[model samples]
Target chain A: MRDRLSFYILRESPIHRMNPLTKLTLVFSLILLAFLGPVEWLAILLFTTVILPLSFLAHVGREFLSATARLLLPVIGFLFVMQSIFLPGGGTALVQVWVLDITLENVNIAFVNATRILTMISSFLLLLLTTHPSALMSDLARRGVPGPISYTVTSTLQILPQMQVKAATIMDAQRARGLETQGNLMKRIRALLPLVAPLVFGSLVDVEERAIAIEARAFNSPRQKTSLVEIDDRPIDRRIRWGLILVVIFLLGSRLWLK
Target chain B: MAQVTINNLTYTYPLTEEPALREISIEIQAGEFLAVIGANGAGKTTLCYTLSGFIPHFFRGELQGKILIDGLDTANSKLYEIVEKVGLAFQNPFNQISGSKFTVYEEIAFGLENLGLPRDEIRSRVEWILALTGIEDLAERSPYALSGGQQQKVALASILVMKPGVLVLDEPTSQLDPIGTREVFQVIRSLAHSGQTIILAEHKMEWIAEFADRVLVLDKGEIVRLGTPQQVLSDINLLSSGIGLSRYTRVAHRVNQQKLWPKGQRYPISLQEATEAFGRLLSQEGGSKK
Candidate 1:
């Protein structure tokens, strides 16, 4: 696992400068348009034209493409192969692989399904690659998201990495004491008990201390919280958000008309 | 008027038969530096939690008596209100980080942001505290990536940025290395010099002697001694109680046992005082020989 959990790349680009909620709206709109729009090729078309170009605009094109290929390609590729061969309702047979019959209609259906999943995940990746998690949470909190919810999201982003590091240290300590972590399955399973016990209890103690720490800082203060890093909700951002909403509505309308 | 008053205070943690603290009464004046010294489980941490309004509010323990800050009882006031009056920093620096903010600067601003300060005000206060704590260079670094010392300084700055009426630190340097210990103590000394009312629970007797106006000793949740650092830290009997005296005092007590130390001379609690007393004794011996 990566040392840090954030996908955000620190670079100055138009996409990076946009408001987090605006980017969030854009991602959701793209996902909705892909799933609800009345065309089989629409998801793949949006992924290529919109998401790819936006990644470059955000200056995270290389990271975004590589991350998508590395993280999502296997799942999508597996789904396409499996569904194209096993799905049972096609009249024309494309090919025969041993006992399975690959059909033309099933291949088309699988392609649409895989590309839709790709579109949904890639849009979110674009948003995460551009926006800091805490910045997003802060904006959401300012716009009426409860304090605890936002705190949980942002704190988890940071704390998970620290906990991972702590877990590694505990594992190393246990191994040094001859706990046998790298042998037969039973040995590894037994090693998990020693490794997990300390990590869980230690994290529990950290949780209590962290709770007190945040409480001491007035985390639950009965006041409207303010943010230090001001997220710019520019007029242009508002217009873009509205424009995305309209596009989504138009896509839904078109789907209804086609039906 | 006392800035903090703990009148006949006693506390028992949840599900525990023994009380963590008993009959703990003390009045701390504004801007006075009070140091509490005790053995493990001697109620130092418990007293700190009570002072900072974490005992009954956060910990939800059975508490007796009262703790008042600036004429407001902590039991009656909300934790947020009490936090405004008294800021708390504890031992584990890693745990104190809010974990929400990425940078040390933003971490320090977390508390002020929660207080609902305006953007410009938060920026200015965070900047001022960063400079004060001497962590200005670490401003943009992630709080998680910082060393224990830097993280503790950030923790202190985070609380100090709120500008609370009183500061309560519970063994703030216990987990730090020698350099880290010095770095944290320097910040605490600066805060104390700036007339911040501070109640620090500490084990570093030598450093406490230099800054603390009074030292309170606890043994088994009872106040065993309360006096100036000289009076409390120099008491030889404190060693038997598991709260060891300062090295200077121990050395002097060892010398006094051999009749080498001058009669009627009080034991020293710091290196400078120890050297001065020994210097005087050497000169007297030189004069007698002449």
Candidate 2:
């Protein structure tokens, strides 16, 4: 596992410098369009024309494509296979493998669903790639998000990597002690107990000290909080956000009219 | 009046029968470097927490008596309010990190931002503390990527930028290596020379001998010995309470036991004093005639 919590690549690209909330707005707009638009090709079109080009503009195109391939493809692939095999509404069968029949209608439905998920997850990945987690969190807090909530989100992102490192260490130690991890399901399941017990309890112990540490920094201070890094939310950023909102509204209206 | 006055302060954690601290009273004057020494579980950390208002406030335990820091009653004030006057750094540098910041510079500014300082002021203070703590080179580095010593320095700098009236450190160098410990102690020594009121709990007697204006030895939640470094660190009875004496003091004890030293002589708690005493002994024995 990677030690860092974020996929943020530091660069001087304009997309990387865009307001974090504006990037977030772009993400939500793409997802909404993919899910609510009454067109099958819209998902792939958005992914190709907008999301792919945005990644290149952000200077994280390579990172974004690899992240999507590594993290999102398997889940979407599994969903496509399950939906094609189990979907019973289609009339014309396209293929038959033993008792499982694949039909043209179900394939179409599954293909659209898969594309929609790809667009949704790719949009999120794009945002994650371009914007740092702390920058996103600080922007959110500035926009009326609660301090503790932002703290929780950013801290969770950090804590997960540390926990994974801990788990890996325990697994390595247990393996050195000759605890079998690669074998039948029962042996592998047995290895999890030794690895998990220490990780869970150790983190639980750290939670108290971490809480006190943050409290010592005045985490619950009643004063108006100030930020050290001044994020630029230019007029264009606000206009873009407004534009994204309008697009979302249009998508919802079109869906309602078609219904 | 003293900057910190704890009067008969006793505390017991929630869901526990035994009190972690009992009848502890100490007065620390302004600009004093007071060091607390004790064996593990002897309430050194508990006392540090109480000093920083975490004992009764953050821990939610039963606290008795009063802890007055810079004239604010910690028992009545909220944790946030007390934190403005007292900043605490604990043993584990990793745990002390706020974990919400990407750069060490922002991490140091976490406290000031919470205090609502303007951005320019925050920037100036953060930069100043980064230099003060000797971490300017690490300003742009990720906090998670720092070494143990660097993280501890960042933790110390984070608390120091808030400019609290008193700084409480519960063995800040306990988890560091020798070089790391030296680096942290150098920064702390500089802070002490600048006359910052510090209440530190540590077992490194040599460092305490060099920097602390006063030494406190606790045993079973009570102050067993409290005095100047030379007085308390050289006390033979300190070992009986499970507190380790400085290396110089240990040698002094050994030389005194062998009757090689003059009678009624003061024990040495530092290398300089030991060297002086040994020099006097050598001259008295005519060994300096060469």
Candidate 3:
């Protein structure tokens, strides 16, 4: 059922071989750069060449772009309106739409903002897809992250599909009880109530239970946790991680001094 | 010999006024297969949980007395350490697994890895368990893709990979259909044959009659009877009282009523045994007529 998810994750490719920390660092750097860059198409263009290709390089393929666009499209509409309508100034007033003016200044701002949003979302998607959640959790813990925080982060990915299944189980069970989710809005909500309530309640209970499951698995042991997908401290991997940190510093320097 | 001693154990769910279990005490051997049976609200599930360290730990409740697993009190031991000795594959097979990205193979390895076995050892043990459960082919497939029966096997395999000596189940096949039920029993049969201590709480007594070594009848959170299958099924009134009689035994019971067989004698636990016993009686009657 989830075969493709398993297939794509935990593979021994060079990208998967790199440390998740390194990937996390790089993605954070990319998002920071995207945030700090000038609201000019040229900066977006320059960043896209460096940042966007990393998704493909990490083996997510063309579907990566579609996934990013899918996630960003709804976000873009809200941000676009904000930049267009709520901007402090306008180069030239083009038209009035409702309470806001459409101006060339707003148009330029919207484009830059949308591109930046897409950049952040895409970089995150690329990094997470290559690294399994357990490995990521282990890496975070080894880096001195607290167990509860790391557990909350990793186990959601672990527990989400379980909740998803629980929801479907509820749906099927409710259907058998003669509830129709495909009906009117009220009926759909009514039908959904049985599914949602139990799932939420069950998940709340599961959090407590999973807390023990984690502890029972030695998660609370004072000894350090070892990842099954152990990343050797390769020179190349170290260099890449240090390199990303340096890039973030360089960009921070550029943003401060070059302005 | 390792033994589980329950001394004056009583449990009450926090919101409820009535105690689910009342002053229950029983002892089970280290590698014993004890099948507990009772009607709904009979406290059968509660007994299983309390005995296996899930009652006070996982479920919030007022628990009285102590549950000692192999002389180690559950109250004193950590759940993870206890879990290493006792594994529960929950009845809802799907929710029991921790991660979905793991294939059938990785699902089995998940718990084993947590137990900190060496890598090669984990590999061989996973392979061994997949074959032991007879799901080696399904190793590479996602857990979501398998049928209810196959997923249950994968779930069992995952728990078994840790090689926990005792396995407890709460109506493992209740969710499955007839065929799935049969397949689940087949896996359980093999596990029992391999000498794993199996504690199954089931309402379906026919399969339990054929498979279980000992039957513990729980009625209102008390052990009413503990005996061999032949000894327990022999009494019609006792069987119906709360023991959850098997289908074949019920049939044998009906026949006994028609003929009024010898009183206080044993009842049949299986169809074949019933047929043989009835056949012997019929042959004796014919010989007397001749």
Candidate 4:
């Protein structure tokens, strides 16, 4: 269920116990380095080496690799077919459907681009596999984010499951009205209009009623709203927090000094 | 003492052919509980909206005449001012709760904080309302995690914390079970006892009969009758044909028509009264059940 997405353990290890703010900062910094820093193949290889163990420690290394294969296979196949036929850098024409020439340059460019996308996606997915939404929000709040803003983000996260329930309720209501969602594709697609119309209308009605209820409850009336579930920063959290900060500093420092 | 006053009021829907309310007039005194009863098309909800200043203001209807709250004209009052005077607990509790807090304590504080009370004051008021509604044990628990009855109590506590002059409920306990109904009735009773004018629009007439001092029967957009509980329930002809009557009244009527016992007052509402009235017969006849 989408509700349980927050609880998935990509890997159960000591690293997962690190303070979420620390993990978040580290992941974001790594993403920045990959995207904005030098395009050295060694750096990319090093990033992948660190991420593989993290994936394995999170117990999702197999899933992580298979997912990469699933996404990259088609992209690699398309690149091969196109580059071998028309691209100027495929070394020699390996295949020609008509007048197209496949070359080594196009093959190399596609390979680099596909690898870049795959690595970025895998790293992000691994981050989600190990982090909880509530923990993430608590980290966001502690870093000077306003309570209401954080609450809005957290509640929005919490509401995804509720939206699923609302959608189910709408589907059931439509089914009761004789609109079959389980029918043939065209039939179901046509049936969707009636389903969508009421859901949107009912959601709008709920939004108004909810707004009135919110007004009555005086949600925006208070200047400061306190969070109930406070996250504890253990010693494990502290060490990881410090370690992540040091790595960010060293990487950026080396980038300038080595230059 | 009239917490709410209506004078020669008429409201028609924006595009409808007929008026939703026609020259309706009534005065609800402070601390008095009034129940509005009607069929599906009786305009019970419309009348509440009209008095609360939602009609013509929120709903954009044709309004003629005046509706007042403690002598303040509601026709042109801002919604916030109206909300200060009248707190409406809408029909559905789930849709009525707006905050995303887990605890009932936070929910109760919602309105007081809106009133711009100091943090200490908000804390005290939240604590007071929590105990007042007997939901202190539920303070830490998530409201979305509660049952219908508990959720309704949270909703009531949330509104009651504001201490509005009048509380308007639109079938608040309709979706609740019998036990939940009893819990809601207790809250309403406490609110009324504290001198808050409570307006209950409900279909459950038996509890309403026991709780409210007065009744207003609306039929097809017109105020058919309005009076004290006894005055409304004692009318045999009016009670039978009226759109909404407590189930007990119809049963009492059935028992009254049996003629097995002599009718003196001609109406019985409570189970104790029905039993006590027949106790004399049991004693006189020396009747003993096997």
The runs of at least 3 residues in candidate 4 whose Cα sits more than 4 Å from the true structure, single-residue gaps closed, are A1-158, A169-194, A219-259, B70-72, B102-109, B112-120, B238-242, B256-264, B280-290
Q: Write the per-residue lDDT of candidate 4 for residues A191-222, one digit (tens) a residue.
A: 87887787788778877778767655545443
Q: Write the per-residue lDDT of candidate 3 for residues B1-290, one digit (tens) a residue.
A: 55667888889998998899988877777667788877778787787677667777777879888887767788777666677677676566655555523466766776655566666888888889888888889988867667888887887777777777678887888888888889888889998887888889887877888877788777777778788867765557765565557666777678777875555657787877878877877787788899
For every model in order, the fraction of real contacts preserved is: 0.80, 0.84, 0.18, 0.32
Backbone clash total, candidate 1: 0
Give a tens-digit lDDT track for model 4, residues B42-112.
Answer: 88889877766667556886899888898789887776677778888877787766534435676576576
Q: Compared to the true structure, candidate 4 yields what TM-score?
A: 0.71
Stretches of candidate 2 exceeding 4 Å from the true structure = A1-3, A176-178, B286-290
Going through the candidates in the order shown, the clash numbers are: 0, 0, 2, 18
Candidate 3, position A244, lDDT: 80
C-alpha RMSD values across all candidates: 1.7, 1.9, 3.6, 6.2
Q: What are the lDDT figures for the candidates, one per model?
A: 0.91, 0.90, 0.72, 0.71
Considering only chain A, what is the TM-score of each predicted structure?
Answer: 0.94, 0.93, 0.82, 0.71
- TM-scores, all candidates, are 0.96, 0.96, 0.86, 0.71
Cα lDDT of model 2 by residue, B12-130, tens digit: 99999999899998899999999999999999999998999887877888999999998999999999999999989989999988888878988888998888899999999999999
Per-residue CA lDDT of candidate 3, range A68-183, in tens?
77777889989987888888885798889887788988878898878777777777777767877667766776677876677666445555565667788989988898888796
Q: Tens digits of per-residue lDDT for model 1 on B107-142?
A: 999998899999999999998998999999999899
